[model samples]
Target chain A: MDLGALFGNFNNFLDFTVGGLVIGAIYALVALGYTMVYGVLQLINFAHSEVFMYGTFAVAWTFVLLHGTGDASWSLGRAVPILLVALVAAMLMSAAIALLVERFAYRPLINKNAPKLIALISAIGASFALAEAMGLRDRFAKWFGLDDNLANYVAPNKARDVYSNPVSIQPHGLFHIGGYSVTDVDLVVVVAALVMMFALDIFVRRTKFGRGIRAVAQDPEAAALMGVNSTRVVQVTFLVGGLMAGAAATLYMMKIGSTRQNAGFLLGVKAFTAAVMGGIGNLRGALLGGLLLGVMENWGSAVFGSEWKDVVAFVLLVLILLVRPSGLLGEALGKARA
Target chain B: MLLEVDGLCVNYGHIEAIRDISFGVEEGTVTSLIGANGAGKSTTLKTISGLRKVRAGTITFDGKDITHARPFERVLMGISQSPEGRGCFPGMTVLENLDMGAFVRKDRKSAAYRSDLDRVFDLFPRLKERERQAAGSMSGGEQQMLAIGRALMAKPRLLLLDEPSMGLAPKLIQQIFTIVTEINQQGTTVLLVEQNAAQALKRSDNAHILETGEIVRSGTGHELAGDDSVKAAYLGGDL
Candidate 1:
């Protein structure tokens, strides 16, 4: 409604745009998991949110384990190595959780040819189970007599308390674009996300393993006849998705500075929306959708106030769906073109 | 025999789709199964390729009992199928589809693999022209070619083709059957399932006629093609 107020301050607009992009990068990474899984199995792994959550915990614990806590000052060179370690730790944890979810929650149902609705219920159950486990981490640690320091770091309280980043890497302005300054955080988030995405794109297009994924996505029976182990492909898909989500989790921690037991829930929903917006089963679409959604949400907040940001994002999704039901890039993942 | 199915019974849930059908594909020969839509021809091939579970059967490939082998294991054991409905990966390019067929092979980048690819391209020059094109975007006939060519990429000793001519033009169907004959002559055993009985029987070394879920007749290709009842039921009477 306040169009003039929204567009009047060009610098503010630019700042919001950059902010949106930083968040969008994380969303894109998480959304890739959703899209890739949907492409192959046609099942939305609702537990994927918990996978991202575990990654956040992994990052936080890694910093704690390295004794980097409480606003520790470090040079850029040292900070980079610590961040890399956290990223790897997060990725491994998330991937492990994802595989476990697939093994226990989805695979049995798939093997049994259970109803799609049943699989969805199983995913929701897994999501709740994982979230609750994280929420009750302190109780479990106490009961098990976990190492005092490690337990304190992993589960500070029994409730859903925020876990602040232990490593404090100061943000410095990298450059100015259109009178809006870009920070190191934004640069890292955007660049890292893009690099991972492009790498995934290349893997899907060029590698034999990736070809097996596409084949299974298109026609599992045909793929099996051709000697593609559909089970392995499905497992690898989960692992790849989990790894990307983990990377996104690390970037999210870097930008937001903290995480909670339920942190992944809202962001997971947003990322899933991004996936659908780009086209639910498409990889490139997830990227496009995430960035666009982020920009739109920020611009909407400028116009309608911050409280209306979520409304704006959802509204935009509705409008986009009305115009292009398949999504911006279209649902071509399992049908045609990687 | 390159492949053997004895007393094979397959069921979809409780209802039996294929019932105690026994057949064999001799090495370096083309065997055809001609049947109506629900005559269990596809089910038979699927079971042989390990895509369908056999309720009661013994499948032996090159003297190895493969009754419990997984689909990929079957493929690794030199059995490949261009399944019913031309099950080409629509998302993949023609070349990618071929690469997927060779998924179980260790020498995918070797000269042998390259020569196999060349052999496929030689068989269907259209595929070579559209190697980078998505399989879904091609014509039905072209997809059929890609499916068969993809199966050939596996370098299988026994090729199982189900309904390769199912939705093709008559001319294209003839071309596909010709290629099947050529593939057979190249020393790969073929077990082809087709609705085009006349062409199938003409090219095949042996033939079987399936009705409902059982094989009601079986003989050499020429003998079945000349049989009066076979002509009336499947070959449009005059033939």
Candidate 2:
């Protein structure tokens, strides 16, 4: 561990913190899906990683379709529309996949009253299936007799190869604070995530639909007696979580500049860790956990080298679980709101 | 009849919880199913409310066949239940819990709904006092009140209450029975299941004695309350 590298440079520390927050926003968005689904079903949607993965492809495909890729100088005005389109495309794609997963993979097993472990295994299977589908898109295109140009543009030769955003929005420094720079990308990611989080919080706290969700989470039987359709609530929960993950996918591509076939796998694991760290069923906890995990991992890398960054995050998770099994915010979604 | 159940059969795997049970609740009446533990009282209410599947039965509520209806659909068609053990959302505020009860109503913002809410508060003023309190933190009796209060918020035509007096003090039990009578008088028909036979019989207009998944006897509340066999087995020999 290099002590000087860890704390000697104040400016470098600030940069890492800022970068961590940007990444944290993405993790928080993906984490919301895991936490919300767990809140209602008490089953982890391991396939949620695929939901995020699909969003990344959705955005990339949308850009390619719009003819917005490859060495194109994108003005702020022109980029705004393309960015909005990509965001919507990603969100829609991810949400669609999430609903499909709930409908096909989990719902049947749930309806059959299968054990929870069975549902978990089914989720893992669905995750792998989705990941492989994306990884073998070129083969799929070939089987479908897709046009060569379209196939090359959408699937590419190597599915696992890094896919870059065609219309790159040049990063402009927004502000300088204490010799640390804040870029437009970071501001967008953080601010957008916070706004979405606030919107979700309000939706859950103040809206009737949200009340139904919390009620189902607390007691499904009682909620049904109160006229809540538990099945519909579960579906809505998956949809909302997927939409957030989609938005996160867009922001992630903007900040990190590339995505791969297995891009969502590591990020999804980190987001799952964040959800558990913040309390699996609690909404606000996911946000807090994601940011905290991101910042801590960056700080760890600064001190112990980049190789130890993931190690530090996992160790922190283990330590936190040992201290507070329910995470920092605790595990009550309904209780927390109340 | 506001609600009718004919030959309702429910099973927990091969073991039957309820079998060949038949009952009816007249409009604006309080009916009680008095039975000992494992006599299928809770299972009867659960089946009616659609929480449990009916292996063989026909449930007609408001003249509509509802045996196969979904739980939420039953609630929308004017059946609401305060399930056994005061199944309140422990994490929610009293107000939020009540709001969930009104989930089926489109007129929740209307004055009618407001008055309905006020009527509940009027019935149980303790709920009004602790509207913002987390329901799980409240006392058992208070939780029972919240549970009943939550069911009332749905403005149901038929209300099914299972063991509202369970774990409650004698005075609180008496108070709950009084509220049940009041709620019945307010035009919602009730089907109550209780272990406290004496109180349930006294308050109910009609009563049934269930023993081992079957209705062994049924009569007007007064008639059953006065039966010798009922008195010996359920009413502690004196009531």
- Best model number under DockQ: 2
Instruction: Return the clash pairs for model 2, or none.
Output: none
* DockQ-based CAPRI category assigned to the predicted complex of candidate 2: high
Candidate 1 clashes between residue pairs 3 or more apart in a chain or in different chains: none
How far residue A327's Cα lies from its native spot in candidate 1, in Å, is: 1.0
Best by TM-score: 2
- DockQ scores of all models, one per candidate: 0.81, 0.84
Model 2, B5-43: lDDT tens per residue?
999999999999999999889999999999999999999
Candidate 1 residue lDDT tens string, A59-140: 8788787765666755345678778999999999999999999999999999889998999999999999999888888777
Name the DockQ score for candidate 2. 0.84
